[model samples]
Target chain A: MSLLWRNVFGQKTGDDSLAGFLGSIPLFAEMKPRDLRQLAALVHPRDYDDKETVFSEGDPGSGLYLIRNGRVKIFTRDSSGHEHEIAVLEAGDFFGETTLVSPAVRTASARTLEKSQLVGFFRADLLDCMEKNPRLALRLLFGLTRAMSERLHLADRELKRLHHALHELQAEGQD
Target chain B: MAESNGLTRGHVLLFFLVMTASIASGLAIFSSASRITELLHTATTGIVLPVLLALVLSFLLEPLVRLFERGPLTRTASIFLVFALVASGLYLAFSWLSPHWAEMWFSLRTDLPRYLGRGIALLKEAQARVQEIFPYIGGFDLPSRGRVLAERLFSHILAQTTGSALKIGGLMVLVPLFTFFFLRDGQKIVRASVGLVPNRYYEMAHDLAWLISRQLSQFVRGRITEAAIVGLVVGVGLSVTDIRYAPLLALFAGITNLVPYIGPIVGMIPGILIAMVDLGIGAQFWWIVVVYLLIAQVIVDNFILIPILISHVSNLHPLWVIIAIIMGGKLYGVLGMIIGVPVASILKIVIIEIRYYRQTFALPLGEFDS
Candidate 1:
């Protein structure tokens, strides 16, 4: 509660806290404090209890959520209703960014692994900020595109490996 | 800290502060009532009205500006080019119509009393005819209020010409200046305003803004087209029938069409009166003008114009449109009535969007939907 601790540790629950947190994110690491402050104003802080569903698969995509603390489970449900964990995301990581580029249904469900805090930056707010500060918007957009491209490349490798495995299983069956 | 019923001393203090602030504001408002009203009036006439008129003009002219910009001209150059074209077009129109307008003006000024006398005499003759048919209806006790209203209506239309012209002239000078800035910075201003929405309802707010902007702009475009077509139709019809001041009546028809429901009736009045005057009561030409206007109103305005142009833009119910016009007229007179439908449409979209979001999203009472 002391000002000294708040200032020195950057643990304040406000613009300064948000700026410090955002500064560590790969996308916003180079952003000026002033610009980050503007971004901070647009972020909505949400608290989640352990095992709470952050979002369900097939739900309409909203925006990206940056994990301020704790962890999240990204998983998918198969036809038989078994959940497959895609990834476990920790603090400083973000998810559900496809909504920023376009309105899309969530491909995976997200749930909190423990008590957590998150900061959401909605698509609409991002677009609005872009109009006001085109340069900053472009930088954020570039970061998003690069992140998505990397994700696609990883997905492509996994898909090809699965295809090879399937062909090999078929050849064994034929022999 | 002290607490009563979960209220802390801090909460009590804040409540009292708010109450004090409210009381102070009320007292201040009451004390400066006259000054506030004067300021409001000045602001409305000087800034709001001119800006609104300029916005409407820009809506009508922006397409032309865009078209010119495609012809290897910068946006500024294109805007200026369109302005120059508009100025020359207005000059040509003025030159062409001046003699007729002057003749009509001369007749109006010199023969207004005579015209009123004739109009009254014609009304009396109709009254006598009705009395003859029903002998129980004796000498008419015409209500003083009705007579005053009739006098006011005519005086307002004919006598206030110069005063209204001066006001319009002032507005004309101011409108272009505001419109230029609006055209140049409209998108940035819009984005800035949209950015003010809270994070929870951010997407909904943006969608609502987009919906309203699209609908309103479409409404404006449709209205301009409707007005031009209606004006041309009325003008050509009147000219064919050899009606006096055909062009002027057509212009009136076009301008008044900006207001929904009541406009066509208002547009038809001067033409009807002129017909009654120029051709004696019960004359053939008078009947022809009446029939022609009826056809135009039915075939043109209601059927063709509304359906093809305006119906899709707002989709405002006729009852709501009427209510909006009445409320708007009461608040802001002519301008309010003209803008009422679009404003109402915007409000409808906002309300609907909010309702939808409330139902779909997890909305706690008194807080934004998430």
Candidate 2:
């Protein structure tokens, strides 16, 4: 697995090849090849060893990091110093999406669960590209909007389930 | 473990060696750049000034380009449209204002000595009043000394400008070309510059560049807005008072307004000189103009435009600003002074980024490990 990871990262990355990777991610999926190539120009490939931090909780988030290969764990530590797992993100998954729109501190820490290759897309470059090429920017924005709405819907469902369970427990206790 | 310990020491030693060597070479390169700027200023003001002017002009006009982008125009088209608009506006303004400008220049040349004489007389009268109050300081010949100093300073600025006017005119033609390309392909230019950053530091470099660019844009936009308001107010006010060279003085005020704190004072000099010439000493109108200028400058610049328009864009301290202006002026003349604030802010950002990078990447050793 490590050798494969090394070989994948070691291969020469053409702009089109990078664009292909970005196209799989929903946030950039809607962009045409030409537009994707322009967007891909902003991505910086980074490698991490197993358990190495990508970013820490409360760090000022500056960009999104997409896992090109291997897995990453997103977690937070509570006051008692116990870690709560948020999500185990894999290849094709991108985190820190919130920073693309605005600069805000990270709510959770990201660490490589195994040796990984990631690509960073900075907020600065994203905003710059959007300004220069608004047509492409619109497409990317539409994709991001869809992704966000889906998340919101999922969250709403979770809230409804939790509320339903609370009502059931209350009724039983009252009886 | 011993091998790792030796390697760490070797790394530390190598770091210090590289740091010292880089600093020394950096200073050497800086001096060479300063020398080249001086040479370019003297030999090819046409080339240098156009590029410099275009840079500043692009910064000022970026918002217009962005505005047109919202209206379904491509970036290049928007840039061209903005340039065309500016060109027509300038031509119209020049046609109307040219005659007045020429007449003002003629009057200034012919009446300059008379103005200087009156200024000297006014100074003498003030000196007499001061000496009467404090007789021990009576021997000070401030009036003649001040006249000589003012004459020298005025002539120096005039000489510098006149010497470069022909070259500057030629340069102005090229400014639109430079500005057009800058507004159109500025992002490509910036993105290409990312190649200069090493892989490990690429993200930080890209982020810093954007951060600086945004801050500078805000600063330049705010300054231009402030300058326009102040210039209009000062011009109209002075013209209303029948002051000579109202437009020219107003233009000076607007340009110098880019400099902080001392800028308004420097800008007020020509207006005050005109007042001294037109109304003479002890004249109620002269005092009125002086009072009006003081009130206008204080009220408009300090009380209004700065707070409302230019609200801490660079976030530079007053002391650092003064120092930066001085250093910039010494290095690159007027242009340096104008850009000092933005440059200083960029340096500040670079330092902050370095600190952040260090904190993030530095070895996280336990207290016992070190």
Candidate 3:
């Protein structure tokens, strides 16, 4: 009976499997082992075929998806219908973190590069976690805030570099 | 232009076919409603009601279980603890209230015929006085009509009571058993169900399920709390005012309050009738009882209980609520009337979400064209 239950619902106990995988992700790095187990219980594992769309660019974003195995391409289409590649994500990488705060439309689409396994952690799940364990919810939010701030710093440096290059190009032209 | 016209004609033909099929199915179901009701009363009651009750109980108790899980307990342990707590609470309440309930029941059984007789006599007197003024109202035989209506209602109640009594033992065993399983494995069950959706529609399907579940849980919790508060206030108010069978009246009022628009009025009828019988129509005490019921059920319930507890959960239009209650009553009697508003609200949500998804995607409705 226990074996059948495990086969049907998958093994949910023990911190060495899904909980460990979740802890390896930077976003959930701050969570304690017990907290990881709690969050792992809420994670929904999904499988996708190669070239299958995880979500369309304009689709409503609901949650973060962490790749457990295989590759996913995150891309957006131009106004004239040109697909521009943003990133190729593999195992341990997560996307759609912005939706944890609110359900907004996806700015980019994601599709599997190969047959893939993914784990979804939705906004509703997070809200429920907050009710059940506020401390864990606080740690998650802190991790999310840190990740966003790092991205912001990188973008600011890139913008400054671009501005300097434009000035140098103007100086050369004038000479 | 010719091709466009052909496409338009085909769309029109398809639309008409779909509409005709829907109407035919509706008519067929309507015609077979009596047979369906009979089957439901016999077989379905023994099976379906237990499952339904279990589902409602699990939804109501899930938050508490989650709360307990946050402590030093596993999910399974938390569920068991919740069950134990609820059982203990119910046992205590039963012990405390059982004697008072028995006394109330005995008095009500003894006083019912007198109340009915006096109520009929009062109605006959009113009919005569009205006829003296209007003359066209003569020969109405109001008492006989009232008696017939009363007889039908009594027989219906008796039949329903017998049916429910037979099923109580089964319900006692099944409801808790089903509830325990649901509380323990609800997440696994939901995940397994959602796991079957194709990758393309997975997120949409998941979101829709979550939305529907949230809506139902919120509505159920709010309704139960509102009913309890209304019952308590009405019970205490009547108890202080020399009213007979205050607890029984309050219980009826609480149960009836599950139905929207018409529930409070239905709840007040017996109280009003008893008051008239006891204090004589137009007496000061009778008028006070009438005013108190009005204030308790109408003013307090509408202004306080609904606004605080239920308004946000349902948010259904008054007209739609009335229509749903009437249709529900016509189909499934009192239970239908009670569930009518929530069911309508759910349908409204589904329709709105489907329309929104269709517009947002602009994909062909026939298949996942993208």
In model 2, the runs with Cα more than 4 Å from the true position are A1-21, A28-53, A68-90, A98-103, A107-117, A125-142, A148-175, B1-52, B154-162, B192-208, B280-295, B313-325, B333-370
Could you give candidate 1's per-residue lDDT for residues B1-370 as a string of tens digits? 4456799789889999999999999999897997889888877765767877677777787778767665568668888888888889999988998998999877766665655666677677777788889989775554444456667867787767888899888877888888877766665587578768653344456555654565566677888888888888878777866567788888888877776667777888777777778765665466546544665677887788888777453667789989988888887787788777667876776566566555665443322112
lDDT score of residue B27 within candidate 2:
100
How does chain B score by TM in each prediction? 0.77, 0.75, 0.79
Task: State the local distance difference test value for candidate 2.
Answer: 0.76
Please, what is the TM-score per model? 0.65, 0.72, 0.83
Residue-by-residue lDDT tens digits, candidate 3, B108-192: 7667777777878888888888988999868678898997887677667657766877778778899999999999998789878
Model 1's alpha-carbon lDDT is 0.74
Best by DockQ: 3
Error of 3 at A168 (Å): 1.9
**Model 1 TM-score, all chains together:** 0.65
Better of 2 and 3 by DockQ: 3
Q: Candidate 3 — which pairs collide?
A: none
* Residue B36 of model 2, lDDT score: 94
lDDT of each: 0.74, 0.76, 0.80
- Model 1 RMSD vs true structure: 9.9
Ranking by DockQ: 3, 2, 1
Native-to-model Cα distance after best TM-score fit, residue B189 in candidate 1, in Å: 1.3
